[model samples]
Target: MEKYIEIRGTNLFVKYLNPDSRKPTIIFLHDSLGCTKLWRDFPEKLGNATGCNYLVYDRLGYGKSDPMPTNPRPSNYLEIEADILNDLLIKLQIDSAILFGHSDGGSIALITASKYPSRIKGILCEAAHIFVEEITLRGIYEAKELYKNSNLAERLEKYHGNKVDILFNAWVETWTTSDFRNWNIEHFLHNISCPVLFIQGEADEYGTMAQVEKTVAQVKGKAEKYIIPNVGHTPHKEIPDQVLDRTIDFILQLAH
Candidate 1:
């Protein structure tokens, strides 16, 4: 179930659970500096709870996947990632998918659902950013400092290995760039007609409530929001039971 699959000429580390199942697949996308291994057992637990197959993969330049070119990434990188996800779905022969994405992965999920509505059945995104915010930049700046001063890089190495620096730099440098300030994906929201659930922590350090509010207002889909009190950034990891219960209810409702 775990193997390397060539996606757009890059070998991506992919883990597929119950690939032969006829039920819709739930594709789990990790946050920046995260990989297939970082997702741990959340995918399996969710899959078992919903009786749905699940897929998890390391993006190029992360985990067991092939490295990417070391160059400045363009502002539209998330959109490019969305295109890659579409191709990956085609290569894997997945007819339908429900995306569960976190952080940067959440943004990618929104873009993918917008561009490929037919292939996407629904979306559940946590802490997804549509545009640059001062709070977001502050969080990244703080993280950059932590990476330089603390053992953050060392901890990340356990998951990303030698590719940790590249992945971390890719996330920090790209988001902190001045040109990326105007980098917004709101234009694509109206194109997303499928159901979407935007989940975020009320105490999230990286973004504010505006992120969840604007997303629910802009998306053309039947949009809902779940703002978890006292949680920060990652609700699934912080309060797995609450997230699991809410997500299960969401998926079950989608079946009707």
Candidate 2:
């Protein structure tokens, strides 16, 4: 069975797999609009495929976790997230882990690896946003319009529960912030000190291919890239089987 524990006065909904395996644990973090449930069964499939222990959880305000307060543009959102992660691991008796994060989760994973290199065995990032771009802002503006009219919000509400607005607004508002436009975390990439796999979709609408190309160019570490030909921002969800296959093979390489 899986396990869960609270951290910083919030319920962190976490699921653990392969309890008997000595392999490095994989901690999966969802995208900006994603919650644990939105990932569907990819984590479980990958866990069994790689034979490594796996964990998947919702961030505060997403999925079954507690709602987050407004104003998340902290200079230390990532720092605080990393701290909470360590606390959660300690509470659950887990030490080392490989973080697999998507979109915003991917950014968080990068932040954590840069700051707490010792705790991470590796990191796998998919469709991560490094810096803001005009395309990103425009896409977010369209999303805000969708939230006002389309059934997307209602559909997503099923995954985020009553805190749907909190999750959606946090993502849209933060990225839309004037000060956040110049935000770039590339400076911290060199400090990762661990193997990384970067995956991006050729058709990712929210972020440009240029950002991923920049990461491929700048990150001074063992990093590999796999760009899906015909997918959107959420490749893991848009094309799960292809991603699952690529991820399983890549993660297994670290086993030995």
Please report the candidate that would top TM-score against the real structure: 1
TM-score of each: 0.98, 0.94
Any runs in candidate 2 off by more than 4 Å, and if so which? none
Error of 2 at 171 (Å): 1.4
lDDT of each: 0.91, 0.82
lDDT of 2 by residue, 1-256 (tens): 5545689877878877756557788999888788777888888898888888988888887788888977365644655776777777677667678889988888888888887787788889988877888888998999999999999889998888778887788788788887777788888887877888999998888888887788767766688899888898888888888999888888888776
Q: Give the root-mean-square deviation of each candidate in angstroms.
A: 1.0, 1.6
Clashes of each: 0, 0
The 10 consecutive residues of candidate 2 with the worst lDDT sum are: 71-80
Cα lDDT tens digits for candidate 1, 24-125: 899998888888888878889889988889999998888899987884788999899899999989988898899999999999999999999999999999
Model 1 poorest 10 in a row by lDDT: 16-25
TM-score of 1: 0.98
